[model samples]
Target: MHWLRGMWAAARSGVRLQPHHLCAPRLVLRATAGLALAGFAGYWLFGLAAGVLAMFGGFMTGITTFQRSWRPDPVVPLVCALTMGATTFVGYLTSGSLPLFLTAAAVWTFLGGLCWSLGANSGPIALNNIVILLITVTLPNSFDHALGQAAFLTAGSLIQVVLVMFPPNERWQWHRTVLASALTAEADYARGLKDNNTVHFTPDSFLQAREADTLSPWQAAHQPAGLRGVRGPAEEIRPILASLADPAATGPDTDLSRRQARELLDTAATVLDAVAHAVRQGARVALPPDTAAALAHPQAATVPADPAPRAATHLRTLLHDLIEAANSPRPGRESTDPVRPPIPEQLRQAVRTLRGELRHDSPVLRHSLRSTVVVVAGYLIGHNLPLGHGYWVAMVAVLIMRPDFAQTYGRVASRFTGNLIGVTLASLTLALAHPNELVTGLLIIGCGGLVFLFMETGYAAVQAAGSTYCILGLGLAGESWSDAMPARFALTLLGGLLAMAAYALYPAWETSLLRERLAEWIEANLHYAAAVIHQYAEPAERTALRTRDAVVAARTARLAWEQALVRAADEPVRHRGLPPATAAAAGQAIKEAARITMLLEGNLPQSGTAPVPASSPLATALRQSAREAAESVRNNRAPTWEPVRQALADWNTPNPQEKALHHAGTLLSNALDDITTALDATALDTTAPDMQGTR
Candidate 1:
């Protein structure tokens, strides 16, 4: 027992248990209770068979579709109920014969599979219940007994859905606070870059901010629907953040708030830029007096008051860490100098940009379709072979493959290994005792509880092992062990092989798609960035854009990039769309942007007090170049580099503000170039095959 507890703790250590992680387990427990209760109530009201079926149906539904936004779709649940009822009616018509009941079960399972396959990928838990009920009905049993099980299941599933409809506690507040702080850090970083034209961006700072952003949305989704609903708030703030680079967008009370928030984010950015500079110089770079002052400023009032203290504390700590790391002398420290890393910042940013977009809504439907197709194909070819119950093996194959590549492999291997162990254990247990209902029930509950505890920790294998024991126990229901044990082992192996074949042949690759999606996100962020630049010219409107708002936009872009990276890493070969050169360029572009944000934040006090001339050549050129590059990326055209060259030329010239503008313009141009190349590459690849066929 002690060893098991130790093992369980070790397994759970890797999983970050946020507020949303609790939602699934709570739903599972409530649904289980509901099913049990429904069985008791319905048994007295409508007899045992009907009660059981209702409970099972309800239980299945609850597990499948309990999301934060879950609203009951009465049509599907009622239809599922009717389907189960009809199956029961047919079994009754057959007069309780074992063979007849089996036939009805098989037919219903096929029908259920077909119905589910149509939109199973998108449908709710009720559909899954239908699938489970179909299988349960087919088990060789009395007609009344099967019907009762289905009824109980259905009632339980319904109860779960109702309970889930009520929202959980607002736990997303901390996540939002973290995101808002990260954004402020970025703004501060950007401001600092504006103060020093020679500064380079640090990848580590961007990586940290990106990580925070990546986790934020998933955490938000897990929160109860009612509490901390800040998607709206974040969206509202996006435009303000985007307009930070524009000079016209700085004036008035509202504009001051945006400026303050941008300044705060820029402070963090400045720290990163300083680190990069220190790395380049091989010594600690002393912060400019103005930059140090900005970093020392009190927390921005624009951020939520509740989160402000934590945010300030975190920012201070992060800045201190960056300084310490920058100052540290170590081997290979020379390589930290900002001469472009192999991967481009733009591509990295694009990849990181997809966290918000990739939502997996239909794990089961995808599993079912992929499984069915693979199994059916295998059965058609292997049915006449030496393999007995080959079709059943193929069905098992479908269950093993999943979309999460790491998880799928882990589950398949675990399940196969655990089954081998479990089967041995179960056989030994049965040798000592005769299987009955009470023993079966106890095993089910014990296994189910273990599964609940370890579900997130590698549930597939645990469940598989449990199922192996349960099935073997069922096979012993009034039967001798010798006859059934051998057949059960053979069937299990057959199922595993079919699953393996399907997994190998029909693998779904998400890597390339993730890259493409991330590229689109980069374009969107660029659009927002361009808008921010334009807004700077309209100072009156800048006040309307809060610092919180700008932070949200930057955070959104960072989140997308993080998600894209995860997906790409999952299947790197499949999604390797950006050429090495292009990827490097993109990465550099993001680094430059981060540095620019830092400089801008750090220099706000110096630059903000005096309004630049409207006709300033540097400002006009920066605005024009950024806008054009943004448009070029959107239009899928090659970005013009001439504006960037001109900006760089000015950056090297004498004017201070002009130099700042020039540096920003150059960075924007580089980002645009990377985006344009990626988009063009995508378009060419997508069309090339079609063009070749035409030829």
Candidate 2:
């Protein structure tokens, strides 16, 4: 009954989309188009074997290069194709006996599924090989056949290698674009703060910005030889970014000088825009003189009352680092040497990653077990039922199952819908038109092109195009899958059902995990905020890398909460968590306070300037708020932060630096208050029973 509702809810809704996500995945269209063109040409020239080679090459080309920058010889593509070819030989050699065939297929599915823990894009290769094993078994069992298949695959690989040597302008765009994007998001958040009327810092924009930033470092590493050392993550100069990102990202706008702070934030945005532009063009970053002046003059010692552009001033040093990196060239950083670690280390890491997930409470381990069951169940049903096109059952199963309920259920609905439409059309086509080499070739080309283009835009569309291409491509090999169209569609639906049902085999929902996830998020933010507060109170000589890691960790925990919450939304009445919006406000506020602390890190004691005494109001208030926030966050209770609040209100000593420090304390107090209020609202709401006292 629960599973039925999950399917209905998933099928009724459309896939949730993100903003500006169509940047890189569209490049995949070219590879698919190449597959359609080259695969059929090979079919026409050499035979069915050559066509399969060309088609598989193109398919793997898109999959292998999924996350990498534009470069020749992407590691995963080559590994996948070779694995496919090798496994093809082994599976074919065992095809004569039922026992041997079952053994080979089991090994293929299990071993391939295991590759998932290796890294992103690794699991698909594993699953692809299992499909290849199924596809190969349908052919004659002979070594001579395997050799013919292997030879054509090499030719197809050569074509893909040549094609990737030159790619579109957007190939490495996300890497550099995200560097600028993170800054731009920061700029927007800062500007929001400058308006002085906004309460929330807008968590989604900042979260998206941070996620983008996280992907930049690795992408930049693979951008061919010349574009190598482009400075890692926005954090390289995070101290400056922290301040610039800090004041703008957090605090009480009413507490500070409105006009001056707005100018400071607007100026910082302008500076970042220029930096973003330079990053895109691979040119040196240059800040405008007015912005430079902001950084150079933190304050006039004579007039202690004027607030300085502290973040912008600190940001000047960050600009210099980016400029220096942009102008310099580092050679061969992404080595041509094979990218895999030594076999021993690779095995060790893969085992460690998998073992860690196999705990009694591990979601990933449970998901993996569920996947294994789905694969085995689909195979057993197909084999026993005498379905001629049985591979389609497991093929859809592999494609649809996901690590979580929302995604798996969503893919089940989408894949089943797509396959239904596609297989029906292909059936009509095969029934109406003559089955010849030329017609098959044309269908493959058309469907392949559509598959890649729609991949990121619409899941159902991709499935429709992909299923057509697969059916038509296999028809060229005399598989006659389209002849069994009704059966194939039924099996595809079965695959999807099994995928959906698999999640129930090991139930783990956000409702069950909410307490731990929230606890982890709070703990991470607590450490991050503490590091930031202390830095502001006592300016650091150097950036603390540990503090930066803590920020990253907090962001990670926050993301986990977001993803789990999404899954919880699809769950039953008894299995859901507190709403994301409330949690997000508290979470984002914590990040804002931390970011301000980071920005203030570069406020080193200037040579002639004397440090403020430890007993000063701002200093003492910061210490008190930091202490109170720790307890409040730990217990999910409203803090009696009257000391910090009083300290902020009474610190009428006209000093710009002191005012900024006071604002940081206010941000801390408000953030704690927000956390407490959110928890209270959740506890008071009787509609959801997911959390325990909302703690």
Candidate 3:
């Protein structure tokens, strides 16, 4: 019954999807144009072979890598065609023998997968060629054939570049789209707080926020970059929004103080709605005088007064920051972007990353090996079977298989089932009548549009549209319609089974890395807490930087741990290290520790008259706790409570700052102790291995 419920839930999840937005048309149209032109022209000008290369090399490459990266240069589609062309040529050269192909694929894929640490687009750079290689292995080998393949590959991508150079007709562009989404989300989030409901922000929201800040307008790379007006406000309100959207899902629920907090949240929501609309309508937002006057009063500014953070104060900061960003950004703040790493430095970093991972029991290395084995198996079996288009078996395996077992397993049902629905739809369209240039062109466009539209929706819809396009594309390239569907169906099923089998037999679990992540998280939060404590010793102008660094580091470690936990749950292997409950408790410990650090940092003066010392006793206790926490997490030892009483003897409660520090310290100390208790019960091998840089 439990297994049935899980399956049913997975099926339901496949249907619910995120909606597509219009502000960022991006390079989709251009890529689609390139695809259509190449697919149409190649078949007529050259042959089916030329068409096949164009389809894979041109359109697929352009569209897959169309999204902009962090560096704001004129975003040219650089990776796809190059990767596709190389894979195609390589596959052709190695196809002379199955053994040769397998050896080449294993090595090539390993190197490519190593680049994944580089960035988001790097993953495609890793997998795209392998995907094309799967098809390439079936083609006959010859030098002239490889050259011709290379020439058409170049032509396909060049066409996309040319079309992308053309002007667009949209107003509120990418920045507007991102800003609107963020503002809308925050507005909704504020309302959720006011109504006492759970509010969660998905990862998509983060991507949109990042783009609004980083992306440049098309071709006009020198035209001052993305939404300069909202940059300060975007940075300011992002964390507050995160707090509101925290998955912990506490809602100031019905206490007297919370009732007071709700009224302020409602006002904040109204302000957010106005700001949201102003940004949407391309007008500046105004700071509401009523709220501003309330905050301006010293009495209201020092909120909660109960040691715990005041949501009202947080809301005020959020609203004021939004107003300043919308109406009065500091001079020169909008004039520049943060210094990004130079190309040389970035390359150096990538090389260093690759070198570092080479020695470890890295998942990417293992995943690459798994992917290679499965692809080779599929490739060999398909050839042996009496099936046409045997390459799809390998291609599908490459597409579906991932580094982690659970993720790979989850995709099996979705991909196989999605392929069935998608191919059936396309097959039915063709069965109605043979599609000429016009019919085929419309079908391709519709399918491409849906694929991008539903890309984030989930795997099933994406596969459906993706498979439909592939089948239609193959048909246009001269494959008999009768052969295409059966091949796709049979090959996809075989591929799915192969992927599931590969994972089940010798599945890799992310749990092995959990301790490292936990250690990292503890270290990051400790750094953050120490920075906040040090502020009490001597208030510094640059304290915020330390806090910001801490936030970033903690967020990184937390994300890795969360991903590991999810993967661990689905992973067949368990009892390797911290058991499930202990691991979860450890996660909660770190989360709360991070929150306390954030609160401490928030309470620190940006720059001001030194108040009574907030350090000592409580501050000293927290600093000590942080050190102990990091050491405990790294060494797998239960942290001993070593509370120093010297500072407490000198402490005075009349100082509000000291009181607040005391409160935050108490929380951090409790979290550290919780982590100690959680790990204390573990009975793993105590002899720690020689690991890489512990810090």
Candidate 4:
């Protein structure tokens, strides 16, 4: 019990490394030395049988199978292991030949690929094990030799995991902080996009915001059960984005003001991104120049650095008041003025018609499927080549080929460049000293530690190259470390070419499905906004509605952006015209809508209660005008601001609420005009004959 407690304390202590305090070089050296010693000791004491198994097992565990945000059920790992083990066992029983073993291994690889597409966490690792088992069983080798290798590998994996669990609790904290910072930066970026008014109605900005939003939710979900806390910061941020996306709030006339707001948001977003990056690299967050300026600005300085804290306090107070209100149980009183009947059938039909056209599916999915198929085919072909070590090349291809060619191509170029540098260094190391089993083990540990420390940085390819060198140095398949470089480089190049070819071809059909889907999503969101605004009778209801709207808008925007990429993949010719829109615009619209809805909800009198009125005629006129504007928008009619203008003309109006309502009405009318114009423009451009097939 004491030993267990001690181990727990050590683990906890190790988790506390500050982002900037991690000593990368020392950590790498220590990890390398530890793993090397463990590998050798395991081989000597337990023999190679267990060691080899453990090493392969660890390697399998290290391979990433799913996207970062995916979270599978806890039982998934068990299921994956069972499936992998059972298939291997069956293969061994049915056919005891090398060729048969290779075939089974290939099948296992395909299954792993499928699992990846289906979003499985351990799929790649499971596939690696299957390959290892096949190789061990089929190779003409002594039983003792195979057993020894397996034992050593297993020991290596165990040691690697142990080495990773070291003292430095600050490191973990930094890592978490980094993630949070990235999300924050993304939010700010979205804000900036809206402020710029660069295609305010497009999906580009929304997608980026969605990505950030997704990360936030995932982090919340992944928090350990007992330690889980409320996500108040994200909740507050949600309204800001919602407000941005609300077409009934943000107007073209206020573009300059919106831009200023965006600048502030972008500053905050960059701060967050920097923080996340710093944590991952074991560094501190460094604010950019513009970010510094915004923070220092006199007017913006009043905005809380931590909006979540203020929101949480406010929410708590509001809830308490609500609870008291509920407890007191005020008696219901009849209203002097009767409620209006339901809207006219003609108006309802018109609203339905407008919504139906907007709700049509986008053409993005078809294009995505085509591109995905091409990439997958290329990967299979590259891996299945007659060359001895072509699979590594195939792996590289998988990492580099993205739907967005520019980004994917850049990553591929960087990866290759980094790999070349890493391989050269590894070759020199091998030449300097014959990489014995001990050296090989040390290298693996060293690579693992580097990966662990710098996984957050944009240098994953370099880390992969280091890991590759260590793996090859182990003298597997009678291959010498010194001679492997030339073949490895050639194979990697071939894989890249194949991937490029696949990207260039594969889509035989052209359609605007992606665009249609995006438009539909936007239309659906608009309808949702209308419903929420119309039903804004209570504060609690408004808050819930706002949150839902923000989330949905973010998600839809992300989908639209992703679809656009997919569309570009299928129709490269159209890529130049359909530039990615900033996610901030959509976020801003959503945020604005949320804010207004909240205001309306807050202003609503309690059940059977009437709002206090001003004695002045100007106040009465302003209130009436606001109500008319709201009604007009709800009825899908063009809102006229003549009444609002007349009300505003009276400068000495004494009623604050009336003045507020008049201003709100004016803003709403402007927003409606901007939205209508944007929609018309989008419809015209998208429906053009040449652009019809792009989406």
Candidate 5:
């Protein structure tokens, strides 16, 4: 009964048609027109099969281009085109024998599923390869014919590559957009802190912008001066914003100081927003007159005293630098330095990352196994069925299944309904009108356009258009509309069912992993906090690097936990070992600890300055307590921070000059106490009868 309910709920959620940002019209129109042209020309010159093959090649390549990947835009189209072309040729070669084809298909399907381990971009490309291969095998041919089809497919894809390579005249558009997003996020955070000091802020945009800043050799040599070093100041501003808004460090808002701080924070928000807008639009900064005056010359009296004023001044300076960077002219000359790792090194790193996922516990490995089984099973059943078009069953399964329950189930529901609507409508149209080749060709192009237009709107809409396009394209070929319609409808239904069943049998429920995710986040935060304290204890070049690495790891772990929480939310599983209330409390406590740690990091002493040796004991205690807390979390026991408290007690009367370190230590101890309290509640919750068993 629970499983049935889960399917119903997932189906409901999946079919929702939410509003989403539209893709660029130019990009959509270009790909659609190119596909239409190729299909029509092929049909006019040669035959319907050749036209359909050409359209398939173009559609596959264009879809890859439409995906949101961190890889260079041009690179994706070219790589995917070549990869799909090769897969098509291979599929044709193996199609002579069912056994050979199934074995090869199983291997290909597993590798395609494993491609997710590489990255989001690689996953889609691999899926496209699988799709082309499946479609290719349905039409077995001789070697020469296979080569001709491969060439036609490559030519179709290369056309899209050309279109992408010479897109609209907006060099560095992606970098500018990401950087602008980061600044806008910071601006929103600043404004949010006015009402609530502890508003949640994520550095995801900043991380993306940082990654975008890593330029290729040609980009580095000719990039604008503004883009090169602006992110440093932008990142520096985040910690300062966190520090200024922290009531623990700055005191309550019941006084003049707090009011002044809020006013300055609002001013900073205004400036940051303006800078972000200018950066995104690629225009000169247009600050308000008063904000401009303030940035030009910050007044001492206008800002609060007690580091707030200095922090406000620093904010002003950073804002000024950002504005300048936004408006700075491009470099007149190019450098000869390489900015990215070599191709061989990158391939080696990719291989190492994939190797790390070979473990039994790895989600990629499990997904690959499931994918291999389901695809091969679907193939065997589809082939044995009296109804033809066997590949449709496996294709439907491949299109719907994903790494997580939420996506897999949601897509299964959406894709099935969509295929039903599409097949019925296209079949009705064909039966009613009996359009000629020209009208059919135009209908195919129109459906293709709809697919691109609704790419992000929702899967249901895309699938609806895609299914219609598939029916029309195949109908334009030699297939009878009546025959294609029922086969497609039944096979699609079978594939979605198979996908759902496979996932149920081998589920990777995020609920089961929440405890480990929470533990990882807690451990990372502790390490980050200890690293900040160590900077106070013994400042050095290597110590700074260590601190940076620790913070990065902490952010990564935090992001992973947040993602898992979201994925697990809609999963209809009761009795999650870690209760929601306990998870929320633990998350809040860890975030507070991380914020306090960032505050300490913001006030780190300058290099070559005298170190606060008194903090050495506290740092060591933090490291020891971190390991203990992680183990306790895994065991569903309360974590103790007695050692941290003791270390703080021992440093109770530190030197006056080390007051910052002393105060930060006190806050850390309190945060650790909160974590302990949260974990105690967790211990109590997990032991309850209601939470004793997993779904």
Candidate 6:
């Protein structure tokens, strides 16, 4: 019953096409041109059969080119073309024997699934090759015919790859866009802070920006100054801004410190916007007059002397670096693009990743196992059925199923609904027009264009366009509407149901790991807070670096927990250990604690400054509590903060110089108590066991 409800929920969420304006018209036209040229040329040279195969070859290769990555656009398509050519030829050779072909295909599918261990980009490329293999194997041909077909298909893919390689000569275009977006997001966050609004600062753009830093050898030699080292300071600004505007650190809205903080934040926003605009436009940075003046004399508007930081001093320094980096002169543009890190480095990294995923607990391993078994089972069932085009069943499954439950189920619903609309429309068109080869070829090209145009709109839209395109291409090969449409529709449903059922039987639900995620986050936050508190006890370069590393780990853990919550939201299974309200409350509490720690971190004393000995016990207590609280969280028990409170109470009265540290200690003690209370107020149900586990 839970499984049925889960499927229903996934289907309902999937069919709702939340449209966005993110289309790539230029790329679509280029891809479509590749498809049209090969399709028409093949028809002219060989025959209608060659034209259909060539069209599919060109289109699937175009799909590979659409995957966004830091790699040169031609690299993925070229590799995929080679892989597809080899697999297609092999599949054709083995098609005469069912057992031999099925065995070969199962091996291919398993390896393809494991390709995810290499990277996100590798998975799609492998999937495209697998799809081609599945379709090609069903069509047994003589050696000559098979060789010619593979040649034509490879030729079509090469055509697309050539087109991609010759893109407009704007070096580091993708890198510039992502870096600019990260700066723009930071600018917005700063403005929101100035306005005292709750801003949701996500690391997604920054993460993408970091990925953009992976440059090819040619790019590395001639990388623009703006692209070289701007992201580090930009990333550091997020936490500092969060700390600067925190009311706990800067006092209430009516205070002079709060007003000063707002002014500095506004100036920070202006500086960030200037840097972002320069990166986006490939021009020199031009800071506003007021922003320049603010940076010139940051101390005039610094925060209150004690307890609060003079964050503007550090903020101005970072802003200067950002401007300098963005304004650095551009290198002369070169057309040469060497492979990034060469091929050897990429292969070594892939090997390392695959080795790591070979363990039993790895999600990639589990998913690969599931995909291999389901795809092979789908193939066997579809082939033995009375339906003529049995490959459609396996093809549908390949197109829909994904590693994660949400994506797999979402795609199942989207693909089935999309195929329904597409098959019906194409069937109706064939029944009415009864078009000839030339007209069918034109229609096929048109459908291909539609697919790419709406590619980013949603999966449902892409599938709708893609299904229509496939049906028209089949028409070019002499398949009638009656033979193609009804069978395809039935098989699409069967494939989706099969995928859903397979997932249900061997599910990898993220919901089961909610408690684990929370525990990791709690431990990380406490460790980071302790690091910051220790800096007050004994400030040093080592402690400063350690604090930096600890904060980064805490941020990563927080992001992991947030992602887990999203993945678990629509999953069928429930976390019996942690209720929804309890999880939210506890997460919020930890977030607040992190924020308080960041506030202290921004105002740390310089090395050789007077050490606050009283903070030592509090720091030690925090370090000890981190280990214990983490264990308590995992066991579904309320964590105690008595050690932190006891350390604060037993300490001697602070001198005037150490009052700020003492006050910060009191704040820390209160924050820890809030976490304890959040857990203690909510009872752990533990009425049922966890559904599943994932790493």
Q: Which is the leading candidate under lDDT?
A: 5
What's the ranking of the predictions by TM-score, best on top?
A: 5, 6, 3, 2, 4, 1
Better model by TM-score, 2 or 4? 2
Report how far residue 477 has shifted in candidate 5, in Å: 1.0
Q: List the residue pairs that clash in candidate 2.
A: 242-599, 243-599, 295-313
Better of 1 and 4 by lDDT: 1
Number of backbone-clashing residue pairs for each candidate, in the order shown: 101, 3, 1, 78, 0, 0
Which window of ten consecutive residues has the lowest lDDT sum in model 4? 331-340
Better of 2 and 3 by lDDT: 3
lDDT of 2 by residue, 402-521 (tens): 666766777877787778778777767776885687778777777766665665666777788777877776676676664667777778888887776667656556566754666566
Local accuracy of candidate 6 as per-residue lDDT tens digits, 176-258? 89989989999988988886634446666776676677677766767877666677678667767877787755555557887
Residue 144 CA displacement from its true place in model 1, Å:
9.6
Q: Is candidate 2 or candidate 5 better by lDDT?
A: 5
Give the whole-model CA lDDT for all candidates, comma-separated: 0.44, 0.59, 0.62, 0.42, 0.79, 0.78
TM-score of each: 0.54, 0.77, 0.79, 0.55, 0.94, 0.88
Q: Global CA lDDT of candidate 6, please?
A: 0.78
- Candidate 5: RMSD to truth: 3.0
TM-score of model number 6: 0.88
Measured by TM-score, how close is model 1 to the native structure? 0.54
What is the per-residue lDDT of model 1 for residues 387-462, given as tens digits with 9 covering 90 to 100?
A: 4433444434445445444444445555556566666666666677655644654454444444443444444445
lDDT of 5 by residue, 1-695 (tens): 66677777788889988666667788789889778877776677767877777777788787777776544667888999899889988998899988898899999999889889887788888888888888887764688898878877887787778777675624577788888898899999999988887787797887677667767776776665556556666776777777777765554444777777777788778978887887777677799987777666677324454556556666677777667766677422222122568789889988898788887666687788888898889988998898887887888898888888878999998998888888888988888999998899889888888888888788998899899998887788767889998888789889998998888788777777777888899888888988889888788878977887787788888989999888777676763557788788888988988988887776666678898888888888888988898998878888998888888878855575477677877877888788878778668665444321232
lDDT of 3 by residue, 423-453 (tens): 8988888878788856786687667766755
Report residue 377 deviation for candidate 2 (angstroms): 1.5
RMSD of each: 14.4, 6.5, 5.9, 14.8, 3.0, 4.2
